[model samples]
Target: MSFELRRATVEDLSFARELTSQNMLRYYIEFELPWQDHAFDVAWSERQNWLIVRDSVPVGYVSLSRDMRALYIRELQVAEAFHRQGAGSWAIDQVIDIARGERRPAIRLTVFENNPARSLYERKGLQVQGRDECFLRMQLDISTPVL
Candidate 1:
């Protein structure tokens, strides 16, 4: 199956809310943080969010921000029905390509410490840069050959 990502606009807020509420509640539980509407509010305003579409239907979303130093992945989530289907991996590869094409030195993100997606990030060539109480920061150095 082919996948495409399109910029998500305010009209897509309900789509994002549905996906996040269904699939991402565990992350908040694991971190002992309460889910809040403001979380999505801030994300909607602050990040470049995209919907991952499969055959014209939205199945997932990824939010990212690019700064002079790095391309940061704010969030990545695919519907439970789409797990193990390579959509997430493909999305990450697309983001990596974006970083490389834009001449960014690295891609950076923080995964909740116990989130299983940490392993996926590692498999995609991101290294554990550091960890704090709530999250583990990871970085993939796109300027090097490892990617």
Candidate 2:
């Protein structure tokens, strides 16, 4: 399957937000966290977002941002029908490439402690750097040369 990423615009907000809510709502409820629509709306407007397209159809979206030190993955969500087909991994690889291209030292993200996606992030080379009550902070130190 050939995957392409297209920049997300205002027109894509509903799809992206719904996809994220579908994928994350369980975790939010399980962790006793509030699902804030306004916050997601603000992020959609602020972040660098992309839709993961396969055969011209969108299968998911990824939201990203960066600082001087690292690239941050704010959201990564694949439609349930498309899970296990490698879209998520492909997105992560793309994010890594973007970080490397920009000369960022690392990639960072936070995942709910029990979220299954944590294993996928681990497989892509992000290690848990710390944890609080509800989230695990993970980072991939790309500054180190890959052997």
Per-residue C-alpha lDDT of model 1 across residues 7-120, encoded as one tens digit per residue = 999888888887887887887887787998787877777989989999999989999998988999988889889988988999999899989888899999998887788889
Lowest lDDT block of 10, candidate 2: 138-147
lDDT scores in order: 0.88, 0.94
Error of 2 at 54 (Å): 0.6
- Per-model TM values vs. the true structure: 0.92, 0.96
Q: Which residue segments of model 2 deviate by more than 4 Å?
A: 144-147
lDDT for each residue of candidate 2 in 1-147, tens digit (9 for 90 to 100)? 789999998999999989999999998899889999889999899899999999999999999999998999999999999999999999999999999889899999999999999999999999999998999999999874666
Clashes of each: 0, 0
Q: Compared to the true structure, candidate 1 yields what TM-score? A: 0.92
TM-score of 2: 0.96
